[model samples]
Target chain A: MKTVSLAEMKTGQSGRVKKIYGGRGMVARLQALGLYPGKEVTKLSAFFQKGPVVVEIDRSRVAMGYGRASRIFVEVGE
Target chain B: MKMSPKPKRMVLAGNPNVGKSVLFSQLTGARVVISNYPGTTVEFTRGKLQAKGQAWEVLDAPGTYSLEPTCRAEEVAANLVNSADVVVNVIDATNLERNLYLTSQLLERGVPLVIVLNLIDEAAQKGVKLNVPRLQELLGVPVIPTVAISGRGLPELVAALPKAGRGRGEARSPDERWIWIGSVVKQVQRVTRRRRTWLEALELASIQPLTGIPIAALGLYLVFKVIIGCGQWLEGLLENYFFEPFYLPLLQSLSRFLGDGSFWHGLLIGNLPGGQIHLEESMGLLSTGIYAVFGIVLPYLVMFYLVLGFLEDCGYLPRLAVMSDRMMHRLGLHGFAVIPTLLGFGCNVPAVLAARNLESRRERLIVSAMLAVAVPCAAQMSMIIGLVGRRGGAYLGVIIAMLFLIWVAIGLFLDRVLPGYTPSMIVEIPPYRWPSLKAQAQKLGMRLQHFLTEALPFIFGGILLINLLHLVGVIDLLAGAFAPVFRSLLGLPKEAVSTLLVGFLRKDVAVAMLIPLGLTAKQFVVGATVLATYFPCAAAFAVLVKELGVKDMAFVAGIMLTVSTAAGTALNLLLDTVLPAPMLALFLLGLAVVLIAFCGGSSDRRESRKFTLTKERRV
Candidate 1:
């Protein structure tokens, strides 16, 4: 498994959340919304550079901007 | 059973888009918006259920992921759960792990609870199955599995309602709670991993830039076309059949009965030249008052709500929210704030009410200000189109473009200067489903009923008050006092002052009142601009007061006065020879450059975050 920023992941690629690299407040918020270590999240769509990225996790689609997505580290299983 | 103890106050609690509303409607027989998008309710809704010889009060609060209360809507949800006797916690069966976080919070509240595992149909399709009996035994609550829209398992849900148990809410660490949830899910849930379904594929294609942008544009264009086309067709029918024949003759007869030029006649029928009642110009309670509300505004109000209701019920709104996130970021708002902005064009009252979906008090203030100051509702727009479109489309374009710039500018200013931070949006967009026709019609009818019963009184009462003031010569005195400002500042004649005053009551009527002014194209542009920017209608004003409280309303009022005066005067001076549209557009472009340069104050966001953190610490 190779870990990369969620922002760097291509659309349709699936990964398990490995680490969140952000402020305490933002990290807590993302965690409350179901993005935590070991949970699988698949990228639905990532628009142009710096735009919001859409991801699907456990049957819900969540939208996160690049700034926040970059701080989230995800491991894609090979 | 001692009258069943007033049937127990049952509040349906859940993360947004988990079918709380659908279940609420099924239980209470009250239709509500069931869009898969989060925050469609924005505020809680109450309905009564009479079954099993007990009267039960059912509430459907705005959806929240957890009990921590991030935004105003979540705060509402969290606060509501505190007062309920039995909380019906709706868990999405397919996503049990994520949804259980909120269920765990509800359990900790020590309330008697009924666990509703909703959307079972969708869950089954996704290859997920739950052992409901085992789940119930573990959670120590009565569990009911339901497919809300289809009414599956609803009878069993009612049968199990009386078995709710009050939890001890034993205080435990969040880690322990998570572990407990994981254990429960592992024991009760079976997940079969499978390939993507067609619905999932559609959801994927909806957010990509290349496809999503064009789809959004096409969808929005269709929505507007249907509203405008249906509204105009209804307007034509009302004018020919109802107004010209029935309402007009009755008004003219009332004019003759009171006798033209008499005080009673003038008060009731207004100043009708040649003793004929002019519905639009008469400015009386029975004349323009009823005419404006029922004839002009009602059709557009109905059509807009109907189309909007369909869009909202089918879950198109969240997709729109996703596509607009980048633009919303530049304006310093969460992407979800776009719903209220879209509703603003339909009507400002519901739009202001919808602003509560935003996270902070600062955001609520900014959204309301944006609506009252810049956006024109569809009713107001129709009249503006009727009057302004006659001159040339360019004049009307200038007004709209100017308002859009003001909206962005004010957002930038408030986002910087306000002493709080907007939470970053993490909107949960559910998969789209076909809307039910009966539910859509019921929702649309309910909103239309609200408009007529609530808004018409204010419109008629305002026109009546204006008529009384005019009869008493109070309007003349005020208009005389403000005539200089009205003439030089706004480039309008003094008589137009009354129209501007009536603007505060209803902008639709305000624009209609401008018809008798006979002003130049430039002056009409200035007058309409000031009318829109100065203040919202009486109905919108009351809603803002309720939503923002009196103190914030006063602050918003002060800003409205200052900024509207500046915008109106600026337009008047600039529209001397050439069109002011291009010049104002250029100026706004420069302002955008400056706003982008500073990023609308990065330091301010950090400072506000600190302030909010301190407040939270104190709490």
Candidate 2:
């Protein structure tokens, strides 16, 4: 399946990040944080109205802008 | 810069951060000279003095605690102290007792000593009065009270030097010296108890277990927030306005000319496997590596050093040490571990060496291990925060939680595995005085200059080496060779296999390589964790080899490699099968509970009362 919005991410779940939707230099940064395809990630928390989504993958934790998180699709499972 | 023939040598020795370099600068003027010591790469500064119609060469040795050095700088100071004809023991009079510990050690060594009671004015203003002449008589050395910054007491210090040199020709027992100090103080020194200041009360409150830890946590929280905020702000400016607007286009144009297939093209731009201009993965000189170091790491390190320098100059470090002593003991370290840990925030090499001051071999080993395992040096942290924290603030918390847990857990495990008595911390907490903005700025400038000149070159060279390897297909070979380890053991991609191969050379450069391959969140987390916990940098490895010898260094390296891979693999699989959100969070909460249970029970037991505070007075 193609990547889904990070906002659509389910709590207590796992998925792969398809893309970072927005932020001036965020796409580059998202890549730097290991937010590429074919990698497993678990959603930890989403904050506020349209706030960032926190996720854990590979023993490292990262947060992404909700707008960007939304642009990315994840094949969720478990 | 020319030295006079038969230049009489003078050496400056003092506790770290006591303004010795400032004194050295003032004494020598701007035309002072500096050189490496005879047999060591460590540099020593020498300035010519024309006092008493005799030309004397003054050397500003690095600071140390005692004659026995626990760090490289201290070792250099000890060597200088032994070689010099006249030794100036520059003491910070504010913390008289702890400073005197070093003075006492120097006195035992029988070095020709002239005591520069630096910060005396501050001491007196704070109601600490010293009988200078009585101290001189007691210690059998010349004592002068001068604020080194204002150039006070230089003439008196010069006049008394000849006499002090003669005094050191005779050796005396440390007990005799202590008795002498007692007699001298009895004759001349008088301390009138002043009304307790708010700072004094705060100091007392800060060291008490009930209050101190929360204060420390708050302090750390504030510092981290400020540091992270400043880092992100500066990184935004550099990455967007500075590099993207101007530098990247220029480099991109230059890459076009290099024709992508030429030797310099691949060497400079890195091999764009599909010939795509990968800004993050450009093995080229002008692409990923340069941008990584200059754009990403530089701004953060600059800000970090400034904040740390301000903290150091204000003398809050010693207070923090005292406040954290109890928790540090639980972690199998003394409060002094705070110093090395603080240093590790700047660079791990000195932090590892600074571990020597710990009371036991076990403490040193544990501290050293933790520093290597959990604490990312300024360079690495800059990249991590710049790259990961940018994803979201939550990611910053995640990174912090992961490392903090590792720091605490590894410390606890080592404490259990290695049984040794930890030295009690009786550090003198200097009053919370205002830091001199000018001095702080100057010191910060010097450290930044040192970091740029000495360290940045190594960063570039490491990148260049990786570029060469990528060009020669060596990186691929190594990655393929380690594919089983990465795929099976760590569950990371084969492309990530190369970054880990490069991490040992320099961590920031390795992390920089990640910008190109563009892994998802999972790959990034795994890659960052493995790199952070892996072996020390190339320079640090060399120092460790020298300090620990090849055999012991190998042992440490083996443990680190095994633990790093296992931790990464376990974390990956745990997240996969059983360790979900509540499970991992619950596990962490449970661990904290177990820790509190174990630690509280031990300290609450009857044996704790054996060393109650009433036995000896608190400082």
Candidate 3:
């Protein structure tokens, strides 16, 4: 079991949400969009290192900025 | 019958990227800006609706992920929900799990709700379906499945307005609401996964870097070719048939009636260079004014929206926002900033309005200045292309390079000075689908109408003002006043002073006016670039004021004047001696790439490493 921030995921990789940054409020905000712990999110494309990463979660695509995306810890591999 | 002065108010609320704006436009028969991407509608748009013997004033509230506000716009949305009499909660059928989170919040507020399950067509295509009646029963509100973009189920949604009711359950905590929504979705909705289609594959390909960049280049090239080809074809037809047979005769008759060569005739028909009437080139309200709007620019405006509508409806825009994100970050905005910049290519009026989607005041200022200074609207771009394209593609290329360099420079400077904001992109990219024809036509009609009502007046009014200035001899005085700067700074002729001044009113007309000055190719390119970037048109000016406020607009104006003047002067003095246009384009593009890589490349890795170290310590 390997863990990496979403920002570090290569294009076409898949991972499940392991942890999110900040407190209950931040985690709640991420949960509202289905990015809670254990949700499977596939990295569709990670725009360079400084850009937002595009990921597909529960069949919906979302883009998160570098600062936020880097904070979203993910468990890689099925 | 005493008509109550107070109208029944209903606010349409939804999560971002749902079709609330489409539903708003369909019911009210008024157009609102709709983008496939989230956060497109930043402000409330009000329209009146008459249905079911009750007149309701509908407010389209900005989209929110939840009632709990995360950003400034969402705070406005939360307030709207509290004040609204009845809230029409629009939900995306395809993403029920995500959308119902907001619906549950609305339901908890005790506001009467009518759930419009929008984009049901897309949901169906994806093999997802909702039992509308069952959902209505569970939520204790009327649920109507709607294909909003095409106006389908709108009548049913309207009729269900009277059936709006509070849900069976009381308010709960955020965690409880999520669990409750999950149960509701499971009970009433069905999702059956299907094999991927070619469209789905193509959508994926567009996001991946190996394929998307080439596709974007080809797509943009095609868009430009179509706009130019269509505009020129229409221009030739109108000039040959309408101008030669109809418009010229009418102007000639007016010349006789108003006493030809009189002050009135001169004001109405312009100087008529050698007593010849040319519709496209004439400086008159009756001749060139009508010609420029209807003949020269109108065709391309139609084509651009057609292309734009397709791109938006098919959900390619947010993907573009994703792809352009890194580049935009280097320019000091989130990738979503490209959305407004792209819109600026159509017309800066709406583009300025769209800048509201940016996250912060500083972001708004940057995008507005970028649009006004670096990007030329379709009408302005068309004129530049028509004039410069004849000289050489490279000549056009040089002007673009100069503008691009200035655009990057201004962005870098602003990103440094303007502190306290630069939120990273966090966009929801909708899956691509085929655009609906009926919806596309309706959307196109709305944009064209907006352009006509909002922009045409400014163009016509500008010509009238310029004509009055000419009649009063103010033109000569001002031209003389500005000649030294025009000549020494931009290396353009004295007559170009008036041409550039007219840019304040209408840029396309200003560029077209340059043709009569008989400037060389270098002067023409330099003059056109300066006019395009110097200031926004009157229509765009009004919008920038409303969107950014007076203080911010003044700041933006300062930036525009300084950057445009400096760029124009530099281009005039150094362009010929510099590498030819093609090489210059390549050189500037390479320089931009290198600069961005240097600035964004090294600093970010260090910042992220430090960020992670701090997080590790905290953990």
DockQ of each: 0.53, 0.01, 0.65
Off by over 4 Å in 1: A21-25, B5-7, B30-34, B108-110, B166-172, B191-199, B419-421, B549-552, B580-619
Candidate 1 at residue B12, lDDT? Answer: 91
TM-score per prediction, in order, is 0.90, 0.75, 0.92
Worst 10 residues of 2 chain B by lDDT: B32-41
Cα deviation in Å at residue B253, candidate 2?
2.4
Deviation (Å) of A51 in candidate 1: 1.7
Residue B310 of model 1, lDDT score: 77
lDDT values, one for every candidate: 0.79, 0.66, 0.80
Q: Model 2's DockQ?
A: 0.01
Docking class of 2: incorrect
How does model 1 score on DockQ?
0.53
Full-model lDDT, candidate 3:
0.80
Give me the displacement of residue B548 in model 1, in angstroms. 3.7
Higher TM-score: candidate 1 or 2?
Answer: 1
For residue B316, what is the lDDT in candidate 3? 84
Model 1, span B1-619: residue lDDT tens: 3356566688999988888998999999887766656777778999998768777899998988878876678888989999887789998888898898888777787788899999888888889989999998888899999998889988988887788876668876556667788899999999888898787677767788898899899998898688767877898899999999898988878877888778777666777755567787777778877887778787777888888887887788888888887666666676778899988988888788888777667768888888888988877877776568668767776787678777877788777777656655677777777787877777777777776786677677667777787778988998899999988888898988887777877788788777666789888888888888888888888898998889988988888888889888888887745545556656655665666445654423574456456547644
The model with the greater TM-score, 2 or 3, is 3
